[model samples]
Target: MEPLIISTRPGVRHHQLDPVGPGLTGRVFAIPLPTTPLLTDALPYVDWSDAYAVLTPLGAPCRDPQEWAEAIFQGPALWVRALFGVRELVVRLVGIEPGGGHAFATVNWRRDEVLVGTDQRHLGFRASVLVEPGRVALSTVVQVRNRRGRGYFALVRRIHPWVVRSMLARASRTMAGPS
Candidate 1:
């Protein structure tokens, strides 16, 4: 399916994907961080943010926000998992805890959202998965603390959106089962 891309502003784009199947369509939005209370409190100053949304069928296996977060972050995407491992190792070397282990356990769960974050000398980041009736949105906000953080995220931001889109798509397909 062809994706419709719209640039809302500098460093922000909205991507709308054609539905692959009934209730299986998805979108990856590189928009500004939302001004919701939870998000604002989570990361006050956002140097970068993006959100990925996927349509969910009723009775989907991973309908809950926390479940969706686990499926997306810890699901059976071997290459993505490897990348996460490398990120963990690199961050640890810089005195940052990368929130290793089960994704669900590492995050903070609220009523309809699951939040995960880490702060270090270089940078700090917060990510959230919000579950609605028939949609799940995964959003991430990052704050660059210094020049090193700026340089590091500059490299990461190039690939971050693609990685998020891939993980969300894979998780949605896995949870949705065969068509």
Candidate 2:
């Protein structure tokens, strides 16, 4: 079977939420997702501020939050912007870890796009994702519907997990390295 790429309400059913760790090795979020246009599932990985402290793989001091955010967020954002026809993307983590021991987490992403020269008269699309780690290696599939069309809007669905996965690997190593 091919890696499932969920970008619709129905697509959510095609995938499963198989986390790598739990009951101590989980995530902690900084900011929470909204109450509308809910994601396929709930992501209790990040925190309320949309920030979290990840353990460096090398067991060194944790890198600056800004560093992590910069490395993690910007990379995927740029990827979507360049690789896909996306206008803007916002990624957030939604879980908690009071102590600090997490293998992976969810990246809630909200992407928007404008439909130009399409069947519709410049439609807009948006969606929320609960990205995690597992079989697909990435969770969260952003889906937008034209408030004016066949329930389908411009889309660049689920394109951040791979970026985040690869990026976090390197970032975790950097953070873990001894200073």
Candidate 3:
């Protein structure tokens, strides 16, 4: 998979970047969490947030945001699934719902996006896939409720970018099919 290019500005658009460079094939750009009304209404407060986007190919199999979100959690991103499994075990030991009571996470499907997340005693997180005109953006937001939540998120924040980038790249390629 192509590496993800980190963007400093939250308002940077995918088209603004040069994706035709030597190392940019199937590029996943780390963007700011979109301010779309749907996402804003769904997750009002965000403590920590990250988003990644990729160009929406013509006739891609997963055109809908929900479909892209599903592709990432369902199969395309194998490492994500493995990580979820470990999360399930750890959460279950603490009496939380195993796997957030849904596949990977609790899913709330919407017209242009699908929200997935879980609210635990320590923290709460919401992730969404937004289908824009020419790109698909995946975003995650976390709100820490307590000290433990802050400590937990501290660890996750370090690796969250790499994980989301990989998942976005894998799902994009899987939906786009053969070059």
- TM-scores of the candidates are 0.71, 0.32, 0.73
Q: Write the per-residue lDDT of candidate 2 for residues 1-179, one digit (tens) a residue.
A: 24332223322322222223322222321122233333323332111101122223232343343444334434444553354322222111211112111112223333321111111122221223222221011122222232422222212223333443455444444434454
Provide backbone clash counts, one per model: 0, 25, 0
| Tens digit per residue, CA lDDT, model 3, 56-98 | 7555444676667777767746677677668778766755555
Residues 1-179 of candidate 1 have per-residue lDDT tens digits of 45455443355443434323333356444333344556657755666666667777766544566667777877747887778778878877866546556333434677788887777677877778777777777777778898878877877776677788888888777667653
Candidate 3: regions farther than 4 A off: 1-25, 58-62, 90-107
Best by TM-score: 3
The TM-score, computed over Cα atoms with residue i paired to residue i, of candidate 1 is 0.71
Global lDDT for candidate 2?
Answer: 0.28
Model 3: which residue pairs collide? none
Q: Candidates' lDDT values, in order? A: 0.66, 0.28, 0.66
CA shift of 161, model 1, Å: 0.7
Candidate 1 segments whose C-alpha is farther than 4 A from its true place: 1-33, 58-62, 88-107, 177-179
Query: For each candidate, C-alpha RMSD in Å?
Result: 5.3, 14.0, 5.7
Which candidate do you rate higher for lDDT, 2 or 3?
A: 3
